[model samples]
Target: MFFTDSRLHFFRPLVGKYREVVVECVRLLYQKLYTDLTGYGQSHGRDFVIDVFVEAIARAPLLDEEVGAPEGRFKDARALAGFILNNLLDNGWMERRLDEATLQSHYGFTRMGRGFAQPFVESGKLEYRSRNRNTRNTRNSLQAFAEKGEVYDLLDALEYSERIISDFADTIAELEERRLQLVREVESRQLIEQAADQFFDFIDTVFKPDLEVRLSADSVEKYRDQIASLIRQVRRRRKYGEGEHAELLWQTVMEMRLRKLLPGRVVEGQSLLENIVHTIEERLQSACDIMLPALRRALNSFTARADIIIRQLSYLHRQADEPLLDACSRLREMSPDNQEQALQRMGQVLAGVRSGWPASEQFVLRSRNRRRTVRATLANAPGLDRDAQKAQFISQVLDQAFHVSSQHIRAYVSDKLITQGRVYSKHLAVQDARQLLALAHVVSLAGERLDNGFEILIHPARSDSAGLQVFEASNCGDGYFDSRENFELELVDRQRAS
Candidate 1:
């Protein structure tokens, strides 16, 4: 067991393997979290791991308070690191990721970041990488790259959480102040209404039209119902000496009564309610005429602007680029209908993108399993085109953009199109997997001009110089998922000698 010496900035004489186990757990959880987040219908999430981290220790009833919050959450590199250290101070290795079976439990290492739902989720298949098709490589890649991404960001976020909270606090404080002002304005408006006409304007209207008069019981019943509705509104607003608001509302009601009374023409054959209905109709019409255009323009203007960013991000998602979600901040007055429309639009576009296009001579299969081929039976069909690829390679671009190597520039077909009798084999070291995961970030960057499909050949080109060569996507008419930092496909082994 160990206690933290806050001054020294290290755990004081911690027991053996405790720190290592803690670090490994943190790393595993973070990696798994992101993978699962991108993965659809996942049982595990960052939230689950965070919940475990909090509950494993006794920080019960986690509060969303700012300031005087855990300072340790700020300085530690890994989110769970401080919590683990604190646990060491309190208890020993009780239970967590200290065993094999527990590690392989639910929310285990199997989940891959997948709903993503635009291009990836629509087609429930992994990217068209050459190696992933071979069961061995697929298993190896998932096992290897599962926990690396957490090392990059989750730890960073945890270590700097306090700073993030502090920044967020300032923003919330501003909103709170604005909210107070709005409350006061509403209170004042209520006071003015009580003195002027009625405290609640909506319920104050006590009269409505009663035209199409008749003598039968059904017609009489309708008129009676209208009379009850009108009386209910009048009574609801008629609070006795409540406040300044009530006084103002009372005065306004009296004035309205005076206007309808007209010098004691109480003996008139026409009802007082008929005149009141005419007044209410005129006012409601005036408000609608003035407000309708402005409301529509505001809604349309915001949707039009937001639709641009949303559409672009949706397309980029197909290309497997990191979606810029903050783009939605530009959207104002976003209704449920708008959201459904945009999401459906993305699905439609993805549907049109027939998989394994340039590589497959003709679309075939009642149910295509692999990410290869979709033969549509149409007499007049459009030419297989990839003008977008040419546009991407148009101008001299960034390093990632220019870095297609040369199998990358060439055999750009789906992996299922690999030669008929060729077999894939790999003895990929764990270290090589780590290196590839790191390089995934470099390869999937924004300016990358990879032609949607490519191959990475990892072989010993010389006696000492075993290296990697990327074949560009020359045959791929179009594709996405080049931005995958956590995954990659490489021709790990190849030999024809029997």
Candidate 2:
């Protein structure tokens, strides 16, 4: 179908033996005639186009046989340029028109010709970084649709999502192509400099500017949740909202003829809005689930191959310069018997080498002295005092006898609450020092996993005498449990727990 078009006949010149001349001519024509701020500025007259073609043909290198032989049929740049220009005009690559005011013919490229020539012109220039903003544009478009509730905004989001997918796919393919090209170069030429240059060129032009940005700030995962939320909100409102919203959505769909954009026949009952939303959702899902992983793998594979090549090159480069490394490489390449012989020879060459303290130098050594021991007799031991022994017994009893724990506190509270449904801190009966200690620990243990079937509520105690009940207890002296806060213990109903 593509070859059936008559306009594509211009491709013949590009594939012919004199393609170099034709390519150069097209590049010059684009640069001179169309590279203007206001795209393809006013067309130039026939003489000007001829001059551009002549310059390109003169600069281009052609085979001596093609230029000087009988079949060439051209002897000078002017004649060759004229023939090429006529071929282009007749083949639909260039157009000629007469201006009424000037009464002369003007020349310019046709639309298809200009489109095809764009890549050639760009490839000749240096591209430092990618200028794509599809990821950011997709996010902004969806956000706009969410805020404005406009059908056009949703359409823009869908378009941007598709563009991002295409861009990622192109990036992956280009990376793989570059990797294969680099591998071929390394295999054919085995030149480290050229390979390193191309590798860094890729990093500067592609990896850092495009892939790195996509993996970080421009990543789909970064904006996936927000985009998904907005998409759902828009779909819900457009699909199920009241009459006014639905009418407006349908009007937009009809006006834009969005139904025609669907790939296949619409289902029996599906609506335009649903189809668009589904398509957009599918594109985003493919990007996240398929494209991202493929991109990561492609990048990792390229880098790993480049790394291995560069490391191998570097090692070879070192082997060529360093004697020791060269020897090791030679030894590795030799047979087992030869390798053993070489190593033995190397050992014999270095067998007498020794550098440390000289044998003539001597130093004296000192001996260590033994430690003295002393023994005590039973007759010299002093008798134990009864007072000290009694004081020690009291100290041990005070330290170990009155230690209270959470179980003890729980038991005390349970005993107090046994007579009633609840009890307050003021009513707690402290019978001895142990009960006083247990009461002190109840507040600390309240927040822990006591597993006690009760809850503690702490509140400020009232200043009235009835609220400030006192408890009498004794350790080795008189003591009272006083506090400004009161705690209430209520039984946890086991019926609800069950």
Candidate 3:
């Protein structure tokens, strides 16, 4: 349908011999009519448009090959400007309308003309506007729909979701372009200073303001959960709507379709609202799971390329600064025979010369002593019988099982203290050799802090006579031990102790 528009024939000027001049003129015209803010006038007259066109023609450099002989009426800049203007007016790129208030004919760009001319104006300019806000805006719009139940908010959210992925794709493309440009510069031998300037210019203009924010706070992944929840809420809320709201939304969607605002065919059984919701969800998922990683990779590649360029530039700079390096490089480039001859000459020149300070110690000539070699012999150990091996393993197992570690001590004390709230050394159940050994360790550990939220307190025995205060520990055929129970164990919590 767009290609069928008669005004698209205006593109003929762009492809003809005067394409450069036409592009320049269009850019200038767009800037004056829309982008330029210096003037307060709402519209431009025919004379003003012709003057702007004349300025563009003068600024443009048309080559001899492109500037063939023209008609007599379009020989000069003003005449050419007039001819171009007439062509634009005939093709609907611009229109001349009389204003009732001013009673004067004012020249203005048509809607299609303004839309087409935007790219001409924006071409070759670095976009500094932050693109990272789309994801956040999408989240906010969804949240508004969830809270306020507005169908327009959902529409706005769908638009923002589409923009988010496009923005990331554009960002990655821009980085790739910049990286390639740097590579070209490096290949062209635009060394250290120029490369450094370009690298930092990219960083200051694009990276810090946009890409950094995109990867961090405004990341799609960061808001994915909230957006998903809000989408679910909006969908759930819309399902319950019966009469007015649903009809209003359907009518609005149809209106948008008529206006060509909503692109693509709607599914047979699906409403536009459902289609929009599904699209938003899919776009968000693709952005988080696919586009975000691609963006990260692009950024890393750009950085790595920049690093390599700087390193190469630095190396070249060093080679330029250092004469010795230059000489070495020349020598390397020389033939083998020539290089050998040059080395021999240098060696002859430096044969008797010393470059550093003399050594503090006098040089002494000493006889060299040869080291005696010793051959390693294999060790022949006697193998033990099965009975001996079994006995040895049993002993090791017993030793490890009854080992008096802090864990064993804590477990034994905790088990005793759980019911009684306190444990005494004399009253400790010495059921076997392990218990007998635990009792000895428990007495030794008295008055110390155990990290199991408890402490051990020792109380002196009442009687000094060993016979009455002696506590004996015996096991059934395992082992036995006896000790004077000179102290009592009390379990105090570390909190109370503190």
Please tell me which predicted candidate would have the highest TM-score against the true structure: 3
Q: How many Å off is the CA of 207 in candidate 1?
A: 32
Best prediction by lDDT? 3
Listed per model in order, the count of residue pairs whose N, CA or C atoms clash below 3 Å is 28, 0, 0
Give the candidate order by descending TM-score. Answer: 3, 2, 1
- What's the TM for model 3? 0.60
Q: Write the per-residue lDDT of candidate 3 for residues 1-498, one digit (tens) a residue.
A: 664555767666665556678788888988887775325655588888898999999988774444454423456898989888887887768888998987999887888888988988777455666678999999999888667656678788989999998998898898899888888877766454687788988898888888889889899889999988877765552232445445455335433542364446555555676677779999999998899999989989999988887788778877789976776888999999999998898789769987887686877779999999887998889999999999999999988986887667667767767777775565666576666677667766666775677777766656655443554445222335544454566778888667
Please, what is the TM-score per model? Answer: 0.14, 0.57, 0.60
Residue-wise lDDT of candidate 1 within 280-362, one digit each (tens)? 33332332343333333433543353344345445545545434354344233467888678767767766876675465756
- For candidate 1, give the lDDT of residue 89: 29
RMSD of each: 41.2, 21.8, 23.5
Q: How does candidate 3 score on lDDT? A: 0.76
lDDT of 2 by residue, 232-307 (tens): 7666534424455555653354434455654364565667766777787788889899999999999998998789
Give each model's whole-structure lDDT.
0.35, 0.74, 0.76
Ranking of models by lDDT: 3, 2, 1
